[model samples]
Target: MEDRNNNNNEIYALIIGAGISGIVLARLLAEKNQKVLIIEKRNNIGGNCYDYIDKNGINIHKYGPHIFRTDNGKIWQFLSRFTAWHEYKHKVRAIIEGKEIPIPVNFTSIDTLFDTTKAKVFKEKLISKYGKNEKVPILELKKTDDKDLRELAAFIYEKVFYHYTLKQWDLKPEELAGDALARVPVYTSYYDGYFTEKYQAIPQNGYTKMFENILNHPNIKVQLNTDFKDLKNTKYKYLFYSGPIDEYFNYRLGALPYRSLNFEFKTLPQKQFQSVAVVNYTSKEPFTRITEFKHFFNQKIGQTTVAYEYPAAFELNKNERYYPIPKQENEQLYKKYLQLAEKEKNIYFIGRLGEYKYYSMQSAIAAIFELVKKIAT
Candidate 1:
């Protein structure tokens, strides 16, 4: 960790991990006449949203396809200034039992899976049974002492929810949190769009270009392939850390559990492959989903690229951090770290990994804006 103290009158801010949140925070602080230095462990800036051309000359996301979508008008408008809009709306389908059904498992999917008479009867039964309360967890339904409701709940649990959740998280449905299950919204309508957010689209160029624009200011200096541990002895006025909360403190409070993913990208000599952008495999397949790159960017190219995502156990050093497992045990562990974070006055933990919460890209940017506002006031 080489620390060169620049004798500048401006406020010095050190941001760890040049991810979306980190970049946004740096931009906001730099605009306020603060001297900002962004240190990224990876050789690139866009973190999980990073994309580049593969050996086959096909542009692919290093992590996965990240579609920019949010209901916040300010966030949408703000991102627009960096890159032109692609005018793309993402839709995903799940391949379950040899059939491709619209994801979020809507009315059309249910109808397609079952016979017309049985489907109608089942729909009526569900409406009459659960009413307009909206579907909760299978466990919640199982708690009902009523035998028939419990049976129905068990049926849905086994058929619809169990295998898919198991494949996605690599854990049993009962082992997972009710909150995780709650995040999966069940729709009665034929809406097949993956996200229900009002404003949804991707950048025309790429997320990398957008991030480059964000960090292009004079006051912001970027250092890639630099780990936070490398700068342990460095002195800064304040630190904005977007890396794992547990890793920040050397996991003294025990490593906060996280779920990781393994992506396998393949190139083919074809224009198109899948029907949609993303296809979820809900069965017991080793790979959970396959994504076609062209569907995401709507690029007209000769060669095509696709990625097969496989969910795996998150080892300490082997895997790239993806999803944070927010079970009761993990939450208790995070609470200990949260207390530690409060004691550290000079350090501010932001974004999903830092705060140990599942946040959308828009929510992460909104957090930066909030922090900037607080600092200004």
Candidate 2:
């Protein structure tokens, strides 16, 4: 990799924000023998997926918990070259009515929340209508004709999703886009796992180290503590931006709304803090969830680190943008910026912030795969 300098005459691509999208694209372009320069406002790469081993020998996710799960074999294989897998399946629990139950309102969750007979009836009704192992969206479940099923839906919606959505996005479930609310579905079976992807695991070492391997190429250069606006005169064949599209245009139209997060990390002396890796505080808690980092890879350590995630409004120059608010007006405003982006040549807006869409880690990489295929061809 080249050293940090203002020289850009030999650069073929300039990627802003050294997140997963930027680093992956840089690696891909470098493989094609194209000179790529990545500028990041932060000193580190991996963005929200960044993780590091602390003194207690626990791999702590700096932002929050990131579990890599993908159905796409090609995308998984692409990342497999960088690091070995830990082979982990994440399980999450949410506190509802002072009892810990599996999220997505699974069969076990139903049993824990409801009486034996009622839980049996609810499960039977759900299976009769949607079939076993089918994941039903909370909203779609509410549309059922059966009164008992509708009652169960109401119970799950109120206990599991309603307050959680409000705390996470500062908006009610109905206010946000349908896709956002559908992410956490009602599982019809006894599956207690958080995700149902074919491949679910974490990097054996860490995300940062894997990213280091990805960026360890001769043609790729990384410049830390550098913003794209500072490189006004640098010349590049193409520009791939992963930062907020509104900020790229200096918010000339208007600042796009986003949700930010603040984490209170604590290293507990005990062997375990929670039974599961993550526990959502669904009711009456200011913070959304508490993540136990040691469970990601089951690292055998005496000390465990947990992060208390508190959602907040995205303030300029205050905190990092985590989630883009998925309201209709926000999408319409994003389109305005998209129009301006289309007019620019050799420039592509990729990833969550750039596209103004909520993307899982796999989805982000999948989007980049398509972008690289189009550009490389």
Candidate 3:
């Protein structure tokens, strides 16, 4: 745990991870004239959102495809400083019953899936009950007594939600939180984009490039492939941790549950593969979805790269924690860790792993923004 080599750079804070949270904290602190040192366990920055141009000159996400979308103008503005934006609205399709349909079960999906009379009946019924341009939750849709509506909900549950949820979380639909499933909005129109956020785009360059720009400040120094445990004895004015909350405490109270994913990337000698960027296989397949990377930024290349995602149990040493398991048991365990974290005087826990919550890219930055505000005052 040696101090940073530069004598001129007096470090004020030490950040455990170089992911978005840690980078955001470092940048915010550096702006306030506080020198920061970031320690990253990985070889590079951007965390799971990392992407690079492949051997075939096609941009590919190493983990999985990430299409940045956020409604927050502040986050958009902050990120804009690092990388120019590529205006790309992402659309995803689900392969169910051998038919590719738009997800969120839109009006177009209903028309494509059912017979003319039946589809019309459904469209009329849905609009009449929920009103036009409304996003009705699947849970609310399932609770209806109407035979057509219940059948529609049941179809969505079985074809869209059931097998996919089972494959993704290793849990049945009932075992998970209602909000997790309820969060899937059923669109009443032909809008095909995955998100309804005001601002949605990918970086003109890759995420790694953007991260490199973010950490390129004079007051900030990054040490890659350095774990937090390596610097346990080192001291600073404050410590910002973005790793697992339970792991920080050495799991004395037991490890918090999380879901992990295994990605299989393939480089094929074809120009195109799937119709869209992402194709969800909502069936009893071992892999949940396959993503064609070129479709994301509309890369013009002869060969394309695709990734197959398989969800698995989060083994401590085997796989990375992709998602915090959203259930009562896990929440209770996280709260215990939170309570422990609260007693510490100068340590701040940020990001998905530290907070033990599922957060989007924007939400993670927003978390850091809130923490920065609190620390500044």
Candidate 4:
């Protein structure tokens, strides 16, 4: 529970971004009686998971909607220390063939899409082949040669995942690695929740307040609008960098590929905009989905805030890098950066941007926990 440990020669660890990875590592180091300084490029912290109460009295995620869900007890317990959580179950529906149906195209979604007899038959066939209540990847479903399964797969792929993938990543399924297609899965049950993790909820107050609580320790010093390059000449015993890994070494080998996003916010006078928190347009819509922010916490407010998500290619100094493109070439290029990072004992690459992987919020926290455990040992 100690804040600032004054015995570490005045300079202990310098953490390069005040995002979840940075903050968690800073708090861990601070607890170990080490002083930590955090520098952030933007005026605020929290990285892509940042959320705040907007001017219209609605909590809006500056990035897209980030619903916290994880099966790891360690990650949940670590985050629970900072803030109370809203135990809200999130359900996502997609507008397909002019009907709003549950995503992953569950049994209910199938019923909604097909006629009664056909839906029942398809359900029976799916159960006979894969068993009930099992989650199957769309590609796996397409692997079947049964005409009925083929029809079912075609419908779901064309209406649920295919166009959506194209819109979200701007790449066909064939172009990317096999793991990329696993992002979307088909549920063989009536379950409608977007996530199947053991724990799923949102921070009660908002992400910002929770982050503030974590970084409030006297040992953790935070400086806003601070660039890492400006403080490059300054030295610390340890530097946990959570910024882009390639950018850290000035893209010495080559710039790793990434996907950014453009978020558009709208405040409507009505209490609710959509039935569900998120509604995906699986068609060739320019924008992917619309999120009604209030649903995250079930906030009782007169007006509702909604955000439209548009995926864009990551450009230098343009949009924020949200996702690392998971392809063979990109992974190979990242490995090259990893080799470079291995040589720098003073700097440790941390988090999504730094590691060049799409680590979920909980995943990032867990990774930080492991990193600090190693430091402690």
Candidate 5:
């Protein structure tokens, strides 16, 4: 990695990791006439959100399927400036008892899983207790006094939540944070959409292209395949790190727990493999979900690509950190790291691994916007 000449051009901000948070922050600061230098350990710029057109002309998400959905108009508008959207609302299904059912346990799912009379009674009871179109967590629903509703919750827990949670997080639903478990709620209505956000979309070109456009600024300089540790004695006014906060401190304060994923990609000589973009394996399959790439933008190619996601333990220097394990003890450890971080000057920890939080695409961008606001103030 070639070092930048600080005499000719002084870097106003040095950003680690060219992921969504780092790229967005670089763009925001560059717009403010700040000279930004972004270094990424990976050769790619978009990090885990990177996508490319394969031999079949299908846009494949390298890591996994990421459906951009958020209620914030500001985040939507901000991303819209870079690329047009596909206007996609993601849908998911899970195989239960040799049948494909919509996830989040909707009315259709209930109708498919149970007998006609029982399904009708369950739906009516759900609407009466939780109101129509409302989402109820399986854990919360298990506490209901209604025997039928409790039965329904138990069925969902055993068939949908239990085995899948065990495979995804290596823990039960009750072990995770409340908000984490509530992510897949049972809708009271017939809505089968996976996400309920107002705005859900994917970039028209690709996420990599959108990121390329984001970093296409005069004041922003990007260096790929360059590790932060290799850049010794680099000078900058401010440092914005989007990598793991624990790794930055050399693991003196203990390592935070995270869940990693291994993807097995296959190019089948067929038009389509699945009905939807993603399908969860809630039963005996060791892998949690499979994603068909061609379904995302409706690519009209003869061949299709799919990825089977296998969740694994996040071993240091072995695999990529995908999810921060949400536990009370993990949060306490992160707070200790936060205390040490707060003592530093002009250095900010951002993004999922950096802050040790589970953040969606929009949430990550919103966080960068807030960080920009703080810097401006």
Candidate 6:
């Protein structure tokens, strides 16, 4: 690989990926009068959050539903400059035993799905059962010395977590990390809101348009269908990579574990299909969740678009990388890669895949802000 720093006043940074993180970073650099070049492997920009009109002329998220929610005041303000906001609060429901229950398995769901009197008794029993432990792994309940708690936990696991995870990732509960279950918050209140972020909304048009606006500045130039490996020998002052870090290094140590996603998109001849933007199937379904695009966009139409999302193990040739598997083995492998990354000068890794961590869109934007400050200072 050849490294050349641009001494001229033009093209100060070269960014890979064209994802939200890359685009945001490029925008920041452009604002500072630093010329930027953004290269994307895909034909279009916006990375995983990209949306487009499908064959039926319906707006669909090519990857999956990416509802923007954040508590960060700065990120929300920054993104607002790119596009008009659509006031859309996301809600998710889970299909359990042929019954639709509000997701996060809240108090209202427990009452509506079960016999109201029995539900009340069960809630009290559980409170008395667990007692003041705000957060406890449902699996840990199974290993408890008490046989009753074990049976209860087993029931909840089988009915709630087990089949959902299996259908979602094609893995049994035991195959998954314990923290996976812990990441899901079980609420005792009637709050069915999916995210508790202070700010929650989707782009008025779509995420792609927002990105187009972000990268539209004169200082930034975008090259599509270009991979980082193709630009290895090219000269640039600095390289900001947002692709898989392991692939960037040619897996010199070993491949970092990542989860991939398969999206099955379909069109329905109706104004609306699902009750909410997303409906998660907690039972033994082939797909994990089904997302309706119209809900997110708040569009009134005769036809609607939806996607069935399935999470699976990452395969080299197939499957776009989704989540990074945060197991001990993967973390150890990533640490080895991190050591190698430190030695490589003028190359910065940003975004979820580049950092080998699972980050939401809000988090990704936050990371970009931090990275830009570091680079500029």
Give the least accurate 10-residue stretch of model 6, judged by summed lDDT.
1-10
Q: Each model's number of backbone clashes? A: 0, 0, 0, 1, 0, 0
Global Cα lDDT for candidate 1: 0.80
Off by over 4 Å in 2: 1-9
Model 5 per-residue lDDT tens digits across residues 1-377: 02233345778899999999999999998888778999999989998899998887889999899889999999989999999999898899999999999988899999999999999999999999999999998889999999999999999999999999999999888899749988889999889999999999999999999999999999899999999989988888888999999999998799999999999999999998999999999987989999998888988878989999999999998998999998899999999999999999888999987899988899999999998887786
Kindly report which residue stretches of model 1 are placed more than 4 angstroms away from their true locations once superposed: 1-11, 55-57, 124-156, 232-234
What are the lDDT figures for the candidates, one per model?
A: 0.80, 0.90, 0.87, 0.87, 0.92, 0.80
TM-score of each: 0.89, 0.96, 0.96, 0.96, 0.97, 0.89
In model 3, pairs of residues that clash are: none
lDDT of 3 by residue, 1-377 (tens): 22334455456799989878888788888777778999999998877788888788778888788888988999999999999988988888998788889987899899889999999999899988888888888878999988999999899888898899899988898899748886677887778888889998989988889988988898888999888887766657788999999999999899999899999998888889999999999898899999998887787778888999999999999999999998998899889999999999888888998899888889899998998888776
For candidate 3, give the lDDT.
0.87
Q: Best candidate per lDDT, number?
A: 5
Question: Looking at model 6, how many pairs of residues clash?
Answer: 0
Using TM-score, give the best candidate's number: 5
Between the candidate structures 1 and 5, which one is better when assessed by lDDT? Answer: 5
Off by more than 4 A, model 5:
1-8
Query: RMSD of candidate 2 to the true fold?
Result: 3.1
lDDT of 6 by residue, 1-377 (tens): 12123347555788999999999999998887777899998999998899887765666888888889988999988989989998878899877777888877666666766777767865665567565324356666667676544655666677778888777656677777537766665564667787777889888878999999999998889999998787755566788999999999898888887778888877889888889989987776678889988777677878988888877888898877888875677888888888888999888998988998878898898888888777666
lDDT of 2 by residue, 63-96 (tens): 8999999999998999999999999999999988
Which has the higher lDDT value, candidate number 2 or candidate number 4?
A: 2
Clashing residue pairs for model 4? 3-219
In model 5, how large is the Cα lDDT of residue 15? 97
Which candidate would rank higher by lDDT, 3 or 4? 4
